[model samples]
Target: MQSVADGSQSSEVPNVLGDFALHLSAQRGLSAHTVRAYTSDLEQLFLFAQGQGVESYAEMELSTLRGWLAEMASRQLSRSTVARRGAAARTFFEWAARTGRIEQDPAARLASPRQHKVLPTVLAVNSAATLMDAARDLAVEGGPADLRVWACVELIYATGARVGEIVDLDVRDVDLDQRSVRVLGKGDRERIVPFGVPAAAALRAWLERGRPALATWSTADALFVGQRGQRWGQRQVRDAVHRLSAIAGVDDVAPHDLRHSAATHLLQGGSDLRTVQEVLGHATLATTQRYTHVSAERLRSSYQLAHPRA
Candidate 1:
């Protein structure tokens, strides 16, 4: 058994977990994205154990792991984050057993906290319009930043992509000739989403005038840039959305809401469930079905207003 730094066995120890992560990524057909997340989770756990003066993962008992989770709970990490961490721990221990690094899977009986099925929040059609108009109004000089702001918000609502996918987008990502933007989403999975004339126009405006103005010798291949002349970060894009939503008088509007609104509106306009799911890059049909609830609510409102019933 590995000795703890404090010379006490509290069921927490640190080991070189990177090799296991690499094995999972290469041999198990796990995506790089998942491998990164799992490794990060292990790193966090290792750091936490070290802070407590524990030496290795093999020394960690179920109760020690539970204590770490309880600490995370006290810090209010969301249920989803907690669940992911639990899954990471479980997988790591199981891998350790398979590789003969451990005698048993210490995380075998551990379970993640149940997550709440929170329905996504979406902007009303009028509110979405307000958001677009507000972003357009903020485009001062029609410069790249302004153009980027315009294009980002417009296409987010139009294409419903996660902000990272948008930030990582390259020049070739947008095919104006095809009227679609190619998005590489989580797991490096690629999909092409169609946008209307307005989104295409905004993108063209940015590419022609805005992007050139912001372009530098050191500029990467990214389509969006910050004031620092570098590619846009996820936080920067999210902050842009937050600020624009505030200006649009819809403070709760987020990048994801634009996605939700886009999917919801498509369904409202008679697009099928599977089509929206494909457009949104959802992995499960049930995940795509939540919009049905939103549509039913809208229908109920329409019936109430038009039925002429007392």
Candidate 2:
């Protein structure tokens, strides 16, 4: 561990952080990305504590945790970011206390600023159709690369999966006959997500024409591949989505917007909350409830537009 005060390395802090990271991975089953985030948050907290002349985890106190949060706020970090850091601190202290690294959990009563729930941007139905149409035109005009882009967009709209999950897909993960794909979600949880006919057609075309052309010895079992015959990257997928959205005259839409649109569309199409939760592989129903708010807002807008009331 590096001292937060003068940038000198420490002995015990690093060892404890390593143990905590192992606990998160082996026991909690958090994804590597999530683990990395937590690790970074704790490291920052430790650095802040050290800067305040606190040297070890045992010296960590509620006031020290609060001071770290205050510093983050003083720097004008977003409420969500502060809240996340607070959560990381809380979890780390709890684990430390449980494992006898600390006599008591200092962060037990730690409070974080309430994060404002910002509604995610979603495409209108016609706009989504236009985006798909544009992608389809590209597929028809270009060769393998075009087909792969189209398939990726279609699957994203159909399944509401994260970009990470999309790029991690292997050939065996998709099942054309079942119209479903096995998605490895956060925490390495697996779920089968169904796709529409358009997505299915696009996938089949990519598998037959696009992927075959791109596949090399290095490609292995990747369902989607880049031009150089490697697994598709998240950046590439994001770029494709942005390009397609721009071509369709819908500016500023990212891959996550498509997922938001899918969830809102599902709710507007009469899908239940629990079902949507399952489909999106959300760990908690509360995480899925945001879409309901989106649906309600849309309904209010539609009512205001169409009704004769003044």
Candidate 3:
């Protein structure tokens, strides 16, 4: 835990935090990333309480939690960040009270600032075609690595999956005949997403020729492998997307951009919000509605460009 105060006043905080982390993982089935984030948030809260002379989990109070959030706000953090931290505090205190680590939940009434709904940047349909064409060209000339990159981009655009979901996929998770993949999302939720023909073609090539050339003993069941022939990580796929964007003469974009583009394009093509929500693995229909705003912005831009009424 990062400390604002010099000395450790109580060992009980760390013990309780460990238990809470296990609870988040084993009982709640939260993804590893979320578990780590909540743990880090609680660590900062514990340290902040220590600095204010509150020594242990049982000693934590609503005022100390409020002060911690106030201090973060004073630092001019984004509303989303501040809100997430506040939510983390609320979760922690509620859990503590439930587990007998605290006598009462301090954050029962905690409220986070509503996160701003900023429109995501998505590639134009023509620009996406340009990117895919460039990816295909590279795949034809280059080796297994090129095919892997090509398949990754195509599948992401087709399914609008998160980068973490793409990298976590095993070969068995994909069904070539059905043109679908089963993604295990946050909280271990699973959904089947259908991809288009372009994605299917790229995947078939990767599975047959590309992956075989790259496979090693350590590769196991992983769909995508790095140069070392092990499971490719999210960071590595992100780096690949960056490089692909550069070479294709497009705006620098991450795998997330492909996801955004896919969602927006689907909406532009008249897909319903509920269908997009299921494909994107969003927990709420509201989360998928953001792409409709993107589509509206694009339409307005086109109208403004072409309309002659002044």
Cα-based TM-score, every candidate: 0.79, 0.96, 0.92
Candidate order by lDDT, decreasing, is 2, 3, 1
After aligning candidate 3 to the native by TM-score, how far in Å is the CA of 28 from where it should be?
Answer: 3.1
Best by TM-score: 2
Native RMSD of candidate 2 (Å)? 1.6
Across 159-224, the per-residue lDDT of candidate 1 in tens digits comes to 988876888888878899889989887655689999998888888888888888776666657788
- TM-score pick, better of 1 and 2: 2
Question: Candidate 2: where are CA atoms >4 Å away?
Answer: 1-8, 308-310
Winning candidate number (lDDT): 2
lDDT of 3 by residue, 194-258 (tens): 99999999999999889998878887799999888889999999999899999999998899999
Model 3 weakest lDDT span, ten residues long: 1-10
Model 1 bad stretches (over 4 Å): 1-16, 24-37, 43-78, 138-142, 296-310
* Candidate 3 TM-score, C-alpha based: 0.92
Better of 1 and 3 by TM-score: 3
**lDDT of the structure predicted as candidate 2:** 0.90
